[model samples]
Target: MTLTFDGTVLVPVADPDDGERTAAALAPLLTDRSTAVLVNVVEKAGGAPDKASVEQREEYAEEIFERARGPLEATDAAVETEIRYGTDVVDEIFAEARDRDVDAVVFTAREGSRFAELLTGSVARRLVKEAAVPVVALPHGDD
Candidate 1:
């Protein structure tokens, strides 16, 4: 039998562009019976001038979800949104996926500076290595 993605999918997005790309990439996988949860995690930090309050972060996450949801509007897939606050983004993503009993986790990879990777680690990499369910990382491209 040909393998297919036919259940709930957990999509974690870090930015609006990433969210858009991810939504487009997953469009073909989604069906009338499928469910997709779009999530954005606001990384919590201590004593930072640039840090946004939880409420502000939630608002931003909502915007990201809206951008992501645009591509799925034509599909029959049931869509959902979430905003989570955590220091460990990878853990929170996995927790959310597991809690929702998702069949797969979808995300996109983007090139980052070495310092940025060192400081935040790579959520895509971590999810690929540790996620219990299938992890799908759309190739980095303008598409």
Candidate 2:
């Protein structure tokens, strides 16, 4: 199916750099009527000690959103930020996508070695394979 940027989109960002790169890649595609929802999934450790405090993660999420906002803001697309919490990152993204009824889920894939991806279970692969909405994988800045 053809992808259009007139409707709302769910954008999952990993970190500040990822956020900036993803937004840069996606910015050119967005229209004046588009709404870009920047989301950072704070993965919760179920029944285990947390790696970071919730406040720390939320602050980091805000930092991500701030970096991501600039590129999209240069365009006419409306930018919004959401900090999501869940044990499963991909699942949380999908849930937010469904909840928002977004036209698409847009992101730039994070770089990693094949072995690293295997060990970490690539979120990019899971997002494309299991997405309920249209999933757009934009090229990274170097690409």
Task: Please list the C-alpha lDDT of all candidates, in the order they appear.
Answer: 0.83, 0.93
lDDT of 2 by residue, 10-45 (tens): 999999999999999999888899999999999999
* Clash statistics: count for each candidate: 0, 0
Candidate 1, residue 29: Cα displacement in angstroms equals 1.7
Write model 1 residue lDDT over 86-141, tens digit each, in one string.
Answer: 77888889889989999889877877887998897877779988878889876544
Which candidate leads the pack in lDDT? 2
The residue-level lDDT of candidate 1 at 111 comes to: 73
Q: Local error of candidate 2 at 30, Å?
A: 0.7
List pairs with backbone clashes in candidate 1. Answer: none
- Top model number, TM-score: 2
